[model samples]
Target: MSARRLTLLVAGAFCLGACSSLNPFSSSNTKIPALKPLTAVAKTAEVWRGRVGSAGRFVFQPAVFGDAVFAAAADGTVVKLQAGRNVWKSSVDMPISGGVGSNGRLVVVGSPKGDVLALDAESGKMKWRVSVNAEILAAPVVSDGMVVVRSADSRLFGLDPADGKRRWVYQRALPALSLRSSAGVVQEGNAVFAGFPGGKLVAVNAINGSLMWEGAVAVPRGATELERIADITSLPVLGSRAACAVAYQGRIACFDLANGSTLWARDMSSSRGLDQDGRHVFVTDEKGSVHALDLSTGSSAWKQDQLAGRGAGRPRVVREYVVVGDVEGYIHVLRKDDGSLVGRLRAESSPILADIQLSGGDVVVQTQDGSVYALGVQ
Candidate 1:
């Protein structure tokens, strides 16, 4: 072959490899197994299914407030549903990139334009709007009379629920290259917990924004930027005595909720988050394996690997099963005690990206195409 033609061929090969590594749909690295047809073993039925505009790649889940559930779409449609009926539907006139946070009295959402808008929960009327100057990819959380928001730039802001006035701002310098996803902030009593790019988890006083404690769940150690990208992108699962977090290329560790002391650490990695029940914590790892760890010690209870390389979301602990959604719109229910696949269902033809939301006795799933389904098991 000619020298120039050979060089061009080599460059094209490298480009294709890089593209496949980054694309979630690409099965070049690992072949995604065909979904096994499930025979109906559990009585599963859809309680309600609805669509807000197309969500595209943005992650938006429903937030429950008393008798109402609030959800938003990428095209700016927000709806309030109760008892399988839409109470009200409205639009913010701008793309909503984050949120569904509500406290019954006020509902909050964030935009790509850095605007945080609050609406009256009763009538879907705009209460207040404020700017934060950065894109918000995670949902805003309302607690302790404050609405907490985390910007994509790693700045955490506390705003007054009454008028969207800024209460406090916490800023941290971010690494040059880091994971852009966040599990948002978890609030408990007076403490607000959030994860950062460097595998760090911080606890702040929700009332005053003062640092309560900071702990490292995982430490970055590799040479390349991709290898050293240890980001704590998942929501920390809070238990009675401790809180646990997982890092993308790092470890899963539990910290004392009262003082942020490391309780136990395990060398596990997951881009998605973790969930905990009374006895165990469930996490979906980067390879699409789901693990159940003991709540007291971080010991492994069980691990399931049938969905590896299938792009699974975080696991949600339901009544007696752990439910997870995958890229092919399949919902798999595994027995919590043994991690055995017991039931399965399909929500839509699109990918299910957001974590499953549990309401009452039903689980709510949101797809990439903006379909929301309330599934119940009988």
Candidate 2:
């Protein structure tokens, strides 16, 4: 299953971004790497299981807020699960695309027709609906005062949380070729960090929608458009003093949080995404190998290639382990000190596209079929 896709939305010999990825990693020629027998150093136990409608081609991740897990499906079902049981299930009355963004009070999602639907978190009732006039592929982020929605046309809208009214809009020139990713933005404090095509990461003021600073996570290179298809396809991972991101056919880097300056960088490529913890940045490359990089210097601390050729999503850090889900629906836990497989558990048979989230100490992930699973690491 293709996690994300390349929509020329292309003018050259095929498109870029994932087109650069699409060519080399096409499923026809790619084979799932065999998993070697692993001695389970840790144990993963299923805490609970919940179900939602199948996502179809859209990406829907389960959002955890306290004990509540909000998840949606492509078929217009938005279900809020508490303890893996439905607290409330509502319908948007339209096919959904991007979603499951919540900041406790407001649960927000996007419709296929570009409508941004804000629902009350407690009751799962519709609060407000506004259209961005473009299809929403990535989830719309919501908070108490502000809501940031990324439209398919590469525009970000800052909306009023009270009602889905536009506060401000931030639009950028998109590259000719790019990957249409379900990856969204990260909002921390007053800044909203978003990665874009051409491998640029920008910090926008959440209050006023002003550009705080821009950092080049990766600059497009290569002679052909496909080779030049460097785009950041995931959310920027935030650390204490730095914000780091990865770009396909590009690099993995950390930028200074204050000024958006590149703190450290190394040649890397990953459409999947990454996580930052302690002194290391963990990323899954395009071909599905996971690596740990030194946070301060971008040095490669270790690499785990056992899962190569298996589609892996962004990693989530829990305690001393890194947990990731793959296309084959196997959750692999790696030792943080060294990239060794520590534990493995099977969740389903479908592909897991969404990021592995954390619910307290348990790991949570929603597969392509919209089955939400919570695993306790012991």
Candidate 3:
């Protein structure tokens, strides 16, 4: 295999099914909840649709900046779209395992061959290519003039944006076993936040790649290694004062943005991520139930469990609603105040494995079958 496999996992990988659908607790409750009847309170429609190559065995989400959205697929296809039109398209000559990461100037993606490829965002030309020598499962983010790429071996490479030269490297200790995920590093201001295998969230200086502080989202404490698994499998969401993250078989916790102080934490398990609207933090638990928790106290404001076992992805807060996509390619728009389904639309027959991205007043999604749709709810 070109990609380095995780330790002690089945078939050389944990494979929560294809497209990261498997949870640690997937053994129980095998039934996918039947969606209750939804009386639409709002209208939802797909404004436009485009196409890219399939994501294959990995996740490929689009990167939105201004009017341009950059997307890629595992078949070496990288494309830039604007106004639902293809602006530029290029091939990387190699398959991409990770998704598109861009700053509107450079587009980046990770190959299964352990290489990071950067292309000019405007013209779709190759700018630079660098090697980390380990498999990169998550998207490489551009933060403060640095390209931050996380490899499967628990190493983060901070490279120069201009030439892909190594600036600094930060390494972490991986546990004996971990659930493989596409959780990438998120940049909030000058600090780059990342999650580790042991349910630890750390903030590092984006410039020098030095560790600033770390906090425990969930601790490893169980008799067996499977029971002790509590890795944060999603990107840490940032608010004005706090950074929040979720873990598989662990808890959802919010920490101080400046320091690693634990603000509040609640027992929750999810491989998908969360989003905050300054008032409430929105998340979908592992069972596909969406929730709204008080941002101040981590208390449950409301719970919408009608979609349990449907394999919902992260929560994206729009103006007055929370939107989430499920394995069946259904987009559910819920009332932010109350978790009632207000609108629904089916974008693809294939599953939506990528996190939702907001672009040009529409929720943009790249389905697992490589179809891109921009849907709007009103």
Better of 2 and 3 by lDDT: 2
CA deviation > 4 Å runs, candidate 3: 1-31
In lDDT terms, how accurate is model 2?
0.87
Write one digit per residue (lDDT tens) for candidate 2, span 214-328.
9998989988866787888898999999999999889988999999988988899888899998799999998889999999999889999888887777888999999988888
lDDT of candidate 3 over 181-296, digit per residue (tens): 78889987768899988999999888889999999999887997677888888889999999999888899999999888999998998888899988999988987899999998
TM-score per prediction, in order, is 0.91, 0.94, 0.94
Q: C-alpha displacement of 237 in model 1, angstroms?
A: 0.9
RMSD of 3: 2.8
Candidate 1 versus the native: TM-score?
0.91
Residue 107 of model 2: what lDDT? 91
TM-score, candidate 3, is 0.94
lDDT of 1 by residue, 144-170 (tens): 489999887778999999888999998
Q: By lDDT, highest first, what's the ranking?
A: 2, 3, 1
Q: Candidate 1, which ten residues in sequence have the lowest lDDT sum?
A: 14-23
